[model samples]
Target: MADLDHSSDDTSVDSREESSQDSKLEFSEDEETLVALMYNLIGERWSLIAGRIPGRTAEEIEKYWTSRYSTVSE
Candidate 1:
């Protein structure tokens, strides 16, 4: 009775939902500065920082920091 093999339709729908949530990040100069400041203050506590920045998810902030800055020193 369990005939639910991985359906392409389900995959496509899930992908669409994820893509919608992960929209392009349009961070202003102030936001970048704030992120840097917040990182320096809290140190990797992304969720707390994201709370201060409107419309930004913790994942986005982490991704931006990783892409822009080197974490080799830490």
Candidate 2:
């Protein structure tokens, strides 16, 4: 029989990819507000939010937040 030891790893990879795809646009007001509140409460700790919201990759949130910060700083 074939081994299925890599199943979990494959699922994780697929989830990450789906998150990346979902990050292309702005999230709804509810989601954005919730994520922002959570970010303020946790500060640079996105894995927590990621756990609650499916397809919300940490990279996308970090990038969007950084971009907003940079724009404001300029």
Candidate 3:
């Protein structure tokens, strides 16, 4: 019987994380307002809300929202 390799490649994951870490997104005042409004209206559906923003991704938005709002709410 031949052995199948089940190990997962983590290089892509590491590269993605590294890229995201390196690329810091600066949200404008308008973008901040939009994100807040959309978050309030949609409630944590970051991907859907991200579509409304031009240069932002769901992960970035989610991270931003969490860092900015999560602690204040608690």
My TM-score estimates for the predictions, one after another, are 0.63, 0.56, 0.64
Model 3 over residues 1-74: C-alpha lDDT tens digits? 12222223466677887887656356789989999999889999999989999878899899888877776653
How many residue pairs clash in each candidate at the backbone level? 0, 0, 0
User: In model 1, which residue pairs have backbone atoms overlapping below 3 Å?
Assistant: none
Candidate 2 accuracy as lDDT: 0.72
Top lDDT prediction, candidate number: 1
Regions of candidate 3 where Cα sits further than 4 Å from its true position: 1-25, 72-74
Between 2 and 3, whose TM-score is larger? 3
How much lDDT does each candidate structure score?
A: 0.83, 0.72, 0.81
Candidate rank order under TM-score: 3, 1, 2
Question: Global CA lDDT of candidate 1, please?
Answer: 0.83
Cα error, candidate 2, residue 33 (Å) = 0.5
Report the backbone clash tally of model 3. 0
Can you tell me which runs of candidate 2 are displaced by over 4 Å? Answer: 1-23
